[model samples]
Target: MISNIAELIADRIGTMPASERRAAQTLIANYPMIGLKTVAEFSAAAGVSSPTILRFVSRLGFQNYPEFQSSLQDELAAQLQSPATRTLNPPSPGGGTVSPMLEATLDNMRETFRHLSDKQLADIAARLADRRGKTFLIGGRFTDPLARYMAAHLAVIQPNVFHLAGQESMWRDRLIDMGKRDVLVIFDIRRYQNSLVRFAEKAHQRGVQIVLFTDQWLSPIARFARHVIAGRTAVPSAWDSSAALFVVAETLIGAVTRQLEAEGAKRIREMESLR
Candidate 1:
């Protein structure tokens, strides 16, 4: 499936020519900041000529720069477009002291944090602390890195950690090895993939515990998840924000670390000694 714009850019970056790839890299690294800037400003920052940037946009299937910016800006407006915020519309069009996008980000965080609880954190931590079977982290096109990030820290402190590949063939290969004792963590966002939803459902039927991290719209797979962690919604943009989902990953890592306690500390020391 075609991913959101940000994910599309990231997916294509490796195959792009040197100049275009550099331009893509700069935006990925500093998205909202780079996204809001004029084409000239962004092109200059990427060290490419202005026209090159426009071509890059076209490569991503955008009709023009404003269309690109509007997609990016949508992520900012999406969350704050709640009835109250819209009805009580701010006096200015986000050009004053507070950037509307920034405000939306704060709102997203607040909502995400508010929904999180000690019990839920501890439950996920317990699942990670269990050593019987492998821990599998599965992230889709846009969220694969977050899954890998989760695998990285969990692997350091624990015995079995695996990052599941996102491709259909590779994903099924990985799923075949999973069983009742294993735990599966998935990260999925909007423009959902039906195949992935089916994968999650199959995993659930196998009795593997599922932990899901997703955006506000909620994945259809959430129903099958043993634990569902929802991210705050971002404003509408050519790309969407996983900022809230990212925090969820970090928090889970922290909780897992705490749960491991003395065992975790000992493992870290041994790992450090090997370096």
Candidate 2:
């Protein structure tokens, strides 16, 4: 599975013809810096044909160049957010013209759902339905909203759902007591937080089951996760479009809710009667 977008592009370059490799190299170097204005604009900037850009993207497992570029931009945003790294390019339209951000968001959502197989969705739902254990969500920085959203929805539908609270130190304290019976749901996409990865690793050591919602299969946090669900966050700007992530989050919640309603309706009815 492709891990990082850069590695995907590099692999494509290795197999591509010499001329295409040069174009790919140019695109890689200039991307997230100069920013991709459009297909024709990128073609001119990369000194290659638009068809070559399409091929490069296809080689990376994307349908076309736009998809590939969007993913790259998302990854770049993640990395640039780190205090150690400076953002090379500010979030701005390269051609001094506004591009359709909403269109890109809708396209990303469409592709994300298209690529998600029914089996994968079912599997995730099953994981969430494991009522034998507690579900704990861990997310930091840009992804905190996702974790909070999932945890809140799950809490109402499923018992024993917990969102990691407090500062990093508080989370660390809570992690010290976590064990295998607990499920750790982590959201770590581009510009991933190191603390989240550490939490996953520690949780893994305790035999905790991890479910990761991230941008790619090769995300570092995926290494220790039991289940990894991929979501497309690439957008026209430096920051990722959360539309895809939100869709997946809602899907997971809906599936889990339906499962509970089907299998645990009697329990729910009893509890409601007492209330």
Candidate 3:
């Protein structure tokens, strides 16, 4: 499967020169929107010269700047697609076919992990395993299950793990308890939730360490995030698949469980005794 520009950037970021790396990081933070701008605009935003920006585009396998911008434009369109729009105008005659759905979902999973590095996972896991700070998980309408799933696992492993649910006001009220020692894990995908973006911004201002799980286009929350895992959620169906994000959540749970093996096992044993 062809990797998106975001995925390509992630794959090559480590190998890029300092100037190119800066451009790549800037693009990842702003995502397709920044790439959609003129080359001069992109160069200015990345704090790199126009030639360096062109080189960065070339390194990503685009033949020219316009081609790079076009790819980003296509991704932007895909990112904004609604379920109703997809259903009304399917990508293919057999867009509803089970095989195509499964294939696309599996590809999404493949492409998601392709960009994720071991160091990134280990660092995030280590932070989550720490009992010195609180961990709070929240998600948008479609992705909340990921927040709940991770929270349920982490709660057993340690204390002060919270799954933030309920109204927007409720989420805001909980912010009072958050601070520098706290970590906020937010799961948000495309047609990105404005409420979550606002919540993330507020938490950022309050000094909360944020880990964001979003789709390739990235949620606006990326600006506030300390760690971000951009999964591939698009598929052949009307609804975007959360399968890849679910897998990513499971991977984190496994990593945290391993890190907290003794504590987690003891907690599990104690809970079993209570039962």
Candidate 4:
């Protein structure tokens, strides 16, 4: 059985027909929710025929529509799992004798990059490199460290990098200053936060382009995002892992730093002189 249906779709999406590709894109945007809908609803959302939807499912290696829906159902269940519930039934690949975290983390990184397109990475990096616009980063309860980490590197690489910390009220206060040229980088995973969603919605209204870093189950913030990186987060443990997302951040940090090499070097020297 395929461990992640989304990853399977990403791997096979290149060879899919145009109609089937639309179905795949639609499914990725809305995720398991659209897959759980009726065939007519799913097709309408994709702007494709019902047969095309079926063909897309088959390409994903499912026998029939119901089987495809069942897989999505299972994924949805796993996405909603709480830490308490996961501990009761942690995935044990080695019959509980050996830990599977290291292997899982490595696999997560491979699958994440395999699905991530070069064009998507480059487009986002270019946006961050543009010094005219401000960049703001935010995250959920557990993921905010990523926001701060990225913001720290970006602060040196370029100007106008802010990590939205503290309360939701504070985030909203900053929205008034945000406008079309600005970008919001959000890190939200499963059990997504409503406050962040609300903040993203407001940011989008002000014409701020969004970059979202989330798990396989795409966060609602994706609808407003200009770019979305759905990294693999699941592991054989009570809590979901952020290691893959961390690598993603580091990769972007390296990419953006390289893109702004000369300027970044001067900034580093200036920072040192100040110290």
Tens digit per residue, CA lDDT, model 4, 165-268: 99889888999989999989999998999999999999999999999999999999999999999999988888899889999999899889999999999999
Local distance difference test values of all predictions, in order? 0.84, 0.77, 0.90, 0.90
Candidate 2 Cα outliers beyond 4 Å, as residue runs: 1-99, 262-275
TM-score of each: 0.64, 0.60, 0.65, 0.65
Off by over 4 Å in 1: 1-98
Q: How many backbone clashes does candidate 4 have?
A: 0
Scanning candidate 4 in windows of ten residues, the lowest lDDT window is 82-91
lDDT of 3 by residue, 133-251 (tens): 99999999999988999999888878899999999999899999999989999999988999999999999999999999999999999999999999998887788888998999999
- What lDDT does model 1 reach? 0.84
For residue 50, what is the lDDT in candidate 2?
78
Q: Candidate 2 lDDT (Cα, whole model)?
A: 0.77
Which of 1 and 3 is the better model by TM-score? 3
Q: List pairs with backbone clashes in candidate 2.
A: 3-218, 78-191
Off by over 4 Å in 3: 1-96
Error of 3 at 265 (Å): 0.8
Q: Could you tell me the lDDT of residue 215 within candidate 3?
A: 90
Residue-wise lDDT of candidate 2 within 205-262, one digit each (tens)? 9999898888854469899988887788877787876678788899988888888886
